[model samples]
Target chain A: MRHDVILRVIAKLLIPFILLFALYVQFHGDFGPGGGFQAGVILAAAVIFYGLIYGLADARKLVPEAVVESMMAIGVLIYGGVGVAGLLLGGNYLDYFVLDPNPVHGQHRGIFWVEVGVAVTVSGVMLKIFYMFADRGRVDE
Target chain B: MAVTVLVIARSRNLFGVIVLGGLYSFLMATVLVAMDAVDVAMTEASVGAGISTVLLLGALYLCKSEETRPVQAPWLPLVVSLAVGAVLAYGTLGLPEFSDPKAPIHTHVVPRYLTELKQEVDVPNVVTAVLASYRGYDTLGETTVVFTAGAGVIALLRRRRKDRKP
Candidate 1:
């Protein structure tokens, strides 16, 4: 793969667009057909594409294992924290109505954060699984 | 789609099987889209087709490329699968027609979601509104599940520096 010029060039051109599309799916989900789960998978797919073209080592360098691990936990925390925030605001658990003075605005805010949390964890888990599978049978440098 | 499955079933090469599996997923995604489940279609396309194929290939890299012949007769498993498929097909006979407006799904909670979505969540996509706001707890649970899966993989597959052979 490292020696394949055509694959390398094409991948280099495509990775950024793939990433951009993932972000589009993530943010535009509120209006369109995509959401955090789809966006997360697309994001991980971009990195995985990079890994396939370049190398696992390069992909690991791009998104470090520690960072991936932390992302997995941090996303869950973010989601749970939203619920806790709602509870603290004198609303039921996972309630979005009290997050802001305007209930509709609070709903938007809550959904946004929740989707972000979902995207983070999903991407992390996907990358982590890819890393684990690709790492197998490799010798230590 | 049926041809793809047949080819996959006949193929002994694991690589071809994985690629065909991706094809099946893509086809499934298309079917989902035809049924107007765009979000689910997107997910199926990305996860089932894209990532799962890559993961299967990665796993294949660590093992044999060709599948070995089964030691026992395949007839029993074949019978079981056919029976299950028949049962599933029979079950689908009881389902409402495609896009039936008066279907239970459309008449039940969907009406409320469709009517109140703008006022309640105010998102253009009802699916997103439902998943993130109306069923926030479920989404939270799903995120936690993903995290737990990642943790479990790390536990099983990660090799520490000290554990490596010198």
Candidate 2:
């Protein structure tokens, strides 16, 4: 795959843009059609493209399976934590209005954090699945 | 989409089936966009067309490119599927027309979601406002589902790697 110069070069060129687009989608989700789930998939797709062009071992170096595994848990924790925070703040579970002094800003803050959690969890899930499928039954060279 | 499905049903080549599956996803996205479900369309295009194709290709790498012919025609399963499809079609017959203001869904709290979008959520995108805030729990559940799916894949596949290793 590395010797495939065109693919490697093009992948080198495109991976960054794909990740940047993922970030844009993640943050701009509130204003547009994209969201955490879409952003996460795009991000994983970028990394998977890197794996396809370089190698699974190299891609693992960039995003170790350990980290990917943690991400799967961490994202859920973040979302759940936000809800717990809402409870601590004297609102009902997942009630965003208590997040900030200003009710509207509180809503924004709540949504932002949850969306980030979703993004992280989704990306971790995608990457984990991709790595699992890609790494299986490898015939060592 | 129907035609593509028919072709996919007829094709025994797993590779062609996967390619057509990707095409079907893209077409589904187009149909979603036409129905003004841009968010769903974006999701379908990215996940269905993009990630799913890559996944199927990886699966194909591990399996034969051609599907093995069954020992006998799966008549029982075929009959079950057709029956299920007919029941589903019948279920939809009583549903209200799309985007009809008089529909039960439209008559619900949608008015609040639309009217208070700017003031409540402060986001112009109603879908985002609704999903992230109003319906946050549902999205949380969806993320959990993705997480569980990944965990399941790891559990199933990683065992093979561990067994193979010295």
Candidate 3:
């Protein structure tokens, strides 16, 4: 792993752009061809790329296993919470029209938050799968 | 595409198979884009070419690179698959033509989405509007599935790690 100077350097340079692209896809889903699923995978790919070059242990240090586990639940909660918020706001379950003063803005706000939740959960799922598989032999008895 | 699948079928090396699978996924994504299913294409690209390839590579590390020969002949499974394919093909004969405006699928909800989507959601991408707002419940279900998969993986692997005695 240490001998591949080019791989490490190239990965370091590309990771930020990959992450930025993921964010762009997430926000631009309404107008373009991406959303939580694609953004989440891209985000996970960035982390996986980092792990491939710098080692999984370093990657885990940056996004701890426990934290990743928590994120899985947190994202789901965020998504469901929005629905619950809508319910509390006098709308039907998961309804976004009653979210704000204007139905249109509320729809936008609802979609944004829901996509954010999806991104978080998706990225968390991907990272969790990677961690489990990568750590299979390394996690010692 | 056919050539890649043939190569994948012939290859015994898991690594090569995974790489070819990623290539196949990339091709499928392109096909989806050509069909104007950009959102689905994006998902296929990310999930198929990106994460699954890496996951397969990770799994490959814990297993043998080359596949072992199977004891049974492939003829029976091949025949069964061909039979199923024939049945599916026959079934398709009763369905509507591709992009037919009169198709039941196009007639029901498609027209509504096409007509009122802009006025209702006002989003340019109707796919987003449908997934995030119009059919929000389905999206919620999908998010829950992803969350559940993550939780299941953690429970299976991380718990085993903790159980290992020092």
- Candidate 2 matches the true fold with a TM-score of 0.93
Clashing pairs in 1: none
Per-residue accuracy of model 2 over B46-151 as CA lDDT, tens digit each = 9999899999998888887987788888899999999999999999999998777899998789988889788877988888888889998998888888888888
**Residue A124's lDDT in candidate 2:** 91
Chain A only: list TM-scores of all candidates. 0.97, 0.96, 0.95
Q: Report lDDT per candidate.
A: 0.91, 0.90, 0.88
How far residue B158's Cα lies from its native spot in candidate 2, in Å, is: 1.3
Q: Which residue window of length 10 is worst by lDDT in model 2 chain B?
A: B157-166
lDDT of model 2 at position B97: 82
- Candidate 2, B22: how far from true, in Å? 0.8
Question: Model 1, DockQ value?
Answer: 0.84
Tell me which residue pairs clash in candidate 3.
none
- Rank list by DockQ: 1, 3, 2
Candidate 1 chain B: 10-residue stretch with minimal lDDT:
B157-166
Better of 1 and 2 by DockQ: 1
DockQ category of candidate 2: medium
In order, what fnat does every candidate score?
0.91, 0.86, 0.84
TM-score per candidate, chains pooled: 0.95, 0.93, 0.95
In the range A1-141, model 2's lDDT, one tens digit per residue, is: 778999988998999999999999989998889888888888888998898899999999999999999999999999999999999999998999999999999999998999889989988998888888888736521
| Predicted structure 3: lDDT | 0.88
